[model samples]
Target: MSEFLIYEQQGPVVTLTMNQPEQRNPLTGNTAVAEFLAAIDRIDADNSVRCVILTANGPSFSAGGDLREMKRQSTPAVSEMDIRQEYRRGIQRLPLALFNLEVPVIAAVNGHAIGAGLDLACMCDLRIASDKAKFAESFVKVGIIPGDGGAWLLPRIIGLSRASELAFTGDTIDAQQALAWNLVSRVVPHAELMDAARELAGRITANAAHALRLTKRLIREGMHSRLDTVLELSSVFQAVSHKTPDHMEAVNAFLEKRKPQFGS
Candidate 1:
């Protein structure tokens, strides 16, 4: 029911759209942030939802934080403590919530994604961008860092040297450059962005939901562990996978030379 975030369900794929196109979908507002977080929580609670496509309907995907709002909160000479507290309540919690989501998040960058907008895209498991899309870590130009987890996510995606250059210069990169740098998984013409994202979601939706969740958990958490630890973790995941009806059906179908039908 929130005006800021709109949710649409398509079988196992849930699409969450930023509805404030007039404001370019800024994430800094308390209402928008709370609504977005609530929508994500709803998606996580839905067992039938396996994937999420994050996108916006505006010419610019998002203009990042609403600097005007920030200024309004600061004009009264708000203390550092007040600003920090506001950030914690409104901005800092975004990345933490995104990271803890149980299902995969796919960012369909339909247009410009600057600063906090780029951070949101970075949080997703995969990014599919349109040719018109532009990405920028605009913090340096404004005398700030990419506050909402961009500093951590950028290096992991594109290596330290590139992340440093982008963070330091605050230069905008085109979708092609983003894809070449592996910041985005793929880039297509503006007309094809949603279709590409939907196709990818459909592919993921065809897989065993339980197996996919276990795989995602293993990959995300196990990548930082040692080989022995990864193997042990995989063993645990395999045991869990074995308990799923999908696994049994897959095994039976393989023996019968047939395709398995997965339950919703």
Candidate 2:
């Protein structure tokens, strides 16, 4: 595992914190992508993790690519093919891993999220930003494009019009603006961000775990599939869900007027 990430679990929830505070938690020039992939694989294998909270340990959520690393790679010795291979083997892998994760994920944005950082937040199913948080699709300002799948992720979250504006201008938007643009669901005081995230996770985990996973899958499928395709997938998943112990427990508890005690 990389020193850049801190992975911890509590009951049904897993928290992944980016810990490279002194360097602003950059995604490149480090082992962050590999660690994230490994941590995600571990979480997928663990049956109990129903929810995830993604946040950073310091002021900036992530500085996107490491500028120092970018400068180092800009030398004439680094060919176009080398850079292409670098991305395919590096930060580009994170979008597919995080987005395809089965459990629900919440990003608690504590501060600035720029370029790939903003794209990272978009990878989560939900986002809760601190009142102090700022976001920007800022690759243009750095004289580069978002080579980390920001082009696709940003437009999907905030729509093509808003995404286009941000990409073209590379201007920063604060928490309130982010909420207005639907980039983030809610904005809370910086001090209350983690509390808010935990409370939301609690609400999510109170239901049948199997049902939650099925529901998340349905939502993700709906994002890219046709209505008929999603409905077909939903039917099959629902059938599987109906046979689980937790589903039976949920139904019986409702009829008995008591709380459900679901199994893992």
Candidate 3:
């Protein structure tokens, strides 16, 4: 039902492929954000989904916002406040929905990820880059800023200094440089990108489903919460995880020296 997303599932892994190859899958000034939020909401509610791979169909992962649309809306009729409100009700929702997603999300960067495009990859829990992938935090080049939370997300992935360099210079970095900066966990052949993503997803989905969600929440909370707060959250999550059917199955499977069959 999504206008721009090609939602496909294989076992416990869901793949959200941005299907705008010609337009480079621009997130804003189009249906991408709405489709993404809807899909993410469904994934959050579906316990069967343990992992998600976010990718695109075209040469560019995403070219960010639509420049022609921006130019059209730059008229005097559209005030500064109007643009601010537009963003608040538009692209800003992407970070919120993606960040709070219950299942782990992996970005399979196939090609160029520019400006907000790069930030979208950062929102994922993990990034697997194609050898031909290129990235740039290039808002400055367009006389704009990263209105999609790149300032926060980029710094957490790479160091503040490195993120600053990218934002300030607005320069593009290839997949190898991204790997060196720890921007992406792995860089594989472009032809093998999806295979690598699936292989990683397989390892993640092999674990107990409920536990994986709980562990991801604990990790996210630990990023911003105090140690004591994280400890409290961990205890609560641990207690809940201990009660899951998957947990019991895992324990029994280990005891019996067999593989676990998780219903969820």
Candidate 4:
């Protein structure tokens, strides 16, 4: 519905493509952030939409931010308080929208993902990269920190040591290196990137939607939790999952020696 983002639905799979490729889909303005949050709201509120694939439509997935826009704002008299208050609302809400999506989000990294772009990909549950894709946490190079969740997401995706190395050095790594470092789930040829992403989404869509949602919630909350706390939380969600119709059908199908037919 919005020009800043394009939302497409095919069966149970949904795709949210960043449409401002000319500006490299920078997350600088209020419009882009609102459009992205709207996309997430659409995915979360639609029960028929079981999976999401995030991608862009140009040579670069995103160039982080509009350099010219930042340049225009840079001035000798600009106070720190003025800068923070100006963009604080947007910077705070964008990451929350990305992280709080109920359904699983897959990053279809098609090209260069630098600075905030890399952080956006890291927000997704899984990442599928095109052969031409390159990832970089270039915050340090620009005299800034990972303002958007890059500092938090990177270490969790890769190990602490590797994430530290990449963030500290601000090095650019190719798709293959990302796969090797476990940043992305897999890498496909450039021609097969979208197909591979769709295939993965399809596989996820074939399962019971309620179960998948609960599982996602479990994993997200369990990542930073202690063993005992996670165990308690797991039991809570698993009990709720067991009460779903699909769970009953799955049990009956197992007993009858046939495949479960999950409802949409």
Candidate 5:
């Protein structure tokens, strides 16, 4: 329904493609941010959608903030506090929404993911980059910090030392380097990016949808939770999963030596 994002659904998988290729799918201004949020809402409401793939249509995954929009907002009329409020209310929402969304998300980085673009990729539960893709924590190059929570997101994904290097340098790294740093889980030929992403998504979608969401929630919680806290949460989630009809189907299928028909 959004002009800036193309949302497509195929069975249990949803693909959110950033459609502003001419602009390199910049995550700035109102349209991009609103569209992304709306897409997340749709995904959350749909129980059938087991997985999401975040990708872009053009050569660049995203160029980050729209420079023209930034320039427009940087005027005598808008104070520093106003800009801070805009970031808090605007682009920052994408990371928060995606991070909290229960569904599993995989970022298919097809090209250059720069500045907040790289941060966007970090928001996903998994990342798959193309061989031609490039990544950069480039906010510093533009004389601004990562206003979209990259500072918090990047360190968690790649660790403090490596994240510090990227943040300080604002230099671009190739797909191989990103994989080496564990910024992305896998890298494939540019032509095979979508296929690889869908293949991974298929693997995930084969499981029970409710269980997948609960499992994803547990993983996210585990990141910041104590071992005991995670254990407790895991037990609760496991109990919930056990109650789902899909869980029964899985057990029966295993005993019968057949593939489970989840949500049946």
Candidate 6:
């Protein structure tokens, strides 16, 4: 609903674009964070939204925290505790919301994803970057740390050693280097970024919505969960999937050598 985020729905796929190019689409300010949370809520409530492509319309995906806003808010009256509380109630919400959302999200990194912006991409289920894109876990450069769940999310995506190097050095890496580090799933030409992202979303959205959501949950749980626990959860989800009309249609259509038409 906020002008900071542009939400465009096309059938089962929704493209959430960060629209403030002049500011390089910073995520710190109240408006962007609130709009992002609201967008997640809206997507979660709409079953028709099977997939999401999070992209930014700018030379930078996001410059991370709004330093201008931070300067404006940084007053002698505001204690360290106040700043901590602000983080908990502010940009931190974006990672938590994206992580918990049932629908699959693909981050289409069109340009630079620095600091918390890098973590934002990590929060998504998948990431695709444009050839011109760059990434950095850059909090250390600004004399701060990754306060928006990057410490947890980054390690999970690219392993501890790589994540540690990025977070500690605050070095920027190009799209190819990101792909080599397993930070992004793929890299495309800048002009083709959206097309590649949409194609990936289409492949995901073609499946049964229920199965996709449940499988995503299973993957998320499996990340920090024991094998036996994940297996038990998977068994339950599998049983539930078996009972869905879409599952039956998929099986039947496979046997008949025809495309399956899934239903809600």
List the global CA lDDT of all models: 0.87, 0.92, 0.93, 0.87, 0.93, 0.92
Candidate 4 residue lDDT tens string, 88-140: 76765777776777799999999999998998899899999999999999988
Would you give me the overall lDDT of model 3?
0.93
lDDT, candidate 2, 98-212, per-residue tens: 8778889999999999888999999999999999999999999999998998898898889999999999999999999999999999999999999999999999989877788
What tens-digit string does per-residue lDDT give for candidate 6 at 1-264? 477999999989999999999989998764889999999999999988899999999799988999976785678877889888888898888888998898999999999999988988999999999999999999999888899999999998899999999999999999999999999999999999999999999999999999989999999888889999999999999999999999999999999999999875
Worst 10 residues of 1 by lDDT: 216-225
Query: For residues 128-225, what per-residue lDDT tens digits would candidate 1 score against the true structure?
Result: 99999999989888776677889988888998999888899999999999999999989999999999999999999888888777777776775367
**Pairs of colliding residues, candidate 2:** none
Q: How many pairs of residues collide in each model?
A: 0, 0, 0, 0, 0, 0
TM-score per candidate:
0.95, 0.98, 0.98, 0.94, 0.98, 0.97
Residue pairs in candidate 6 whose N, alpha carbon or C atoms collide under 3 angstroms: none
The total number of steric clashes, by the backbone 3 Å criterion, in model 3 comes to 0
lDDT of 6: 0.92
Q: List runs of model 5 lying over 4 Å from the truth.
A: none
Task: RMSD for all candidates, in order, please.
Answer: 1.5, 1.0, 0.9, 1.6, 1.0, 1.1
> Model 3 misses residue 188 by how many Å?
0.4
Candidate 4 deviant stretches above 4 angstroms = 76-78
Misplaced by over 4 Å in model 6 are none
State the displacement of the C-alpha of residue 73, model 2, in Å, after optimal TM-score superposition.
Answer: 2.2
Candidate 2: RMSD to truth: 1.0
CA error at residue 70 for candidate 6, angstroms = 2.6
Tens-digit lDDT string for candidate 5 (92-210): 89889998999999999999999989999999999999999999999889898888989998999999999999999999999999999999999999999999999999999999999
Clashing pairs in 3: none
